[model samples]
Target: MARRYDPDRRTRIIDAALRVIVADGIAGLSHRSVAAEADVPLGSTTYHFGSLDELLTAALRRSNENFAQALRDSEVCAGDADGGEGASSGARLADELTRVLGEWFAGERGAIELEYELYLAALRRPALRPVAAEWTTSAVELLSTRTDPATARALVALMDGVCLQVLLTGSAFDAEYTREMLTRVVDGCA
Candidate 1:
């Protein structure tokens, strides 16, 4: 058989890995499984990633962008391009953050579960710890634009806690509660 060429194989493999994780979780991941999901040869998965950790690292790196990109695309986080420089007021920041959180929670449950699963995997997999931290770093960086770095870090922690609560408890997201907590963080209040 002639050697085939596929520039998108790597990206497709990474995407497939995420889908596999979403469907079966970290325990279900294997190069063979990922290759089957990606519709690529098993060798392709090994060629791209020598181990499950490497594949997971790539998958997690990709997943981290989903929420950060959402935050980046937010109106307050992006700021007003039309000279509305003050639009990121604490109140406005809180409001936009809340809205964004609601949107995140409203997304597909599998996707949400995949993201959290990747983060939780860090508890046992040392390689994934930095990727989890990277998720926090990106969110804090996006938020720091609207508030001080300290406040931004606090807000990220707050959001993470709130999200964890909603996910673990199977409770519906409360935008009002999120808004109030975010406001307190943005305002530097205890």
Candidate 2:
């Protein structure tokens, strides 16, 4: 065969990389591993990704977009932005945040952990910082419409902490507690 044409090869590779990361953590990723996971030739991975960092950057960026889309797609959260009708006491916003967190935690825990692993990987991989930040900025921008940017940042931080806590400690996600805590923040700002 002279050459094979696969339009979605790059995407498949990135998706495969995600799966590998999810299964083995970022530490276990490598061109050989991704090629095996993608079922493509090793050269294909290198051709598509000049370096492991480049490949990670692509995977993290795609993962970030997925998370951003989740927030963008949530009607419940959107409704609370801008205080819904008139002025909001932050209850609705808090409720929305709590609900969103509940849904996130309810999702496949491994995938969530993998996403955070990619984010935390930024600590060592400077190339991934922008990709990780994109998720935060996207979340903040979405939340900013409901409240000031400062409050939005605070909310993001709180959500991150709660999410990490749940993941690290293997504890149950308490929706009521989350709602109350978020409400206090929103209420204080209100």
Candidate 3:
């Protein structure tokens, strides 16, 4: 009798690849590793992803989509008050962003690390640049709803810097400090 095929095998392989990337970085990613992580045969990974680059691309795309969804689901700017630029609205935006960042750091720090790994990997691989670009573009688009394009771009950069600092220092994420910085940016944009 033939073996059963899992309909979600591709997704499982992609997710397992992300876990491997998070734990070992892109340098350690391989069909065998992902297969073991996913508890699937090695062939499954190769069948789903013909090469390591393809697997990395899929994993990065999945990771970006998951992070983007988390940002969207947080309703980061859903409470934006309609009217002229006011301190209250700016503060509200900052508070919302702070909350979102806090939650992300508290729960998704590993994923954030994986994201940075993929971003750095893109630096050497020209083909992977599009994945990183898409991730940045998505984040900026999400942020633009709360501020001007230039400020939104700055805020995204700020976010990356802060997250990297926290990750590197292994210190607790300072949401208040983030809020303060975000408020400064939002107020400046107003």
- Return the top candidate by TM-score: 1
lDDT of 3 by residue, 2-53 (tens): 9896899999999999999888888788899999999999998988888888
Q: For model 3, what is the error of residue 88's alpha carbon versus the real structure, in angstroms, after optimal superposition? A: 2.6
lDDT per prediction?
0.89, 0.86, 0.83
lDDT of 1 by residue, 1-190 (tens): 9988899999999999999998888999999999999999999999999999999999999999999999988875765345436654776888888998899888897888899899889999999999999999988888888788999999999998999999999999999989988888887766
Candidate 1, RMSD to the unseen true structure: 2.2
Give the clash count for each candidate: 0, 0, 0
Report the Cα lDDT for residue 117, model 3.
81
Candidate 2's displacement at residue 150, Å, is: 0.5
CA lDDT, candidate 2, residue 152: 85
Q: Using lDDT, rank the candidates from best to worst.
A: 1, 2, 3
Q: Candidate 2, which segments miss by more than 4 Å at Cα? A: 80-89
* TM-scores vs. true structure, each candidate: 0.93, 0.92, 0.87
Q: Candidate 1: which pairs clash?
A: none
Model 2 over residues 1-190: C-alpha lDDT tens digits? 6799999999999999999999999989999999999999999999999999999999998888766777777754465445446636587888777877788888898878888899899999999999888889989998887788888888889888988998899999999988888887867734
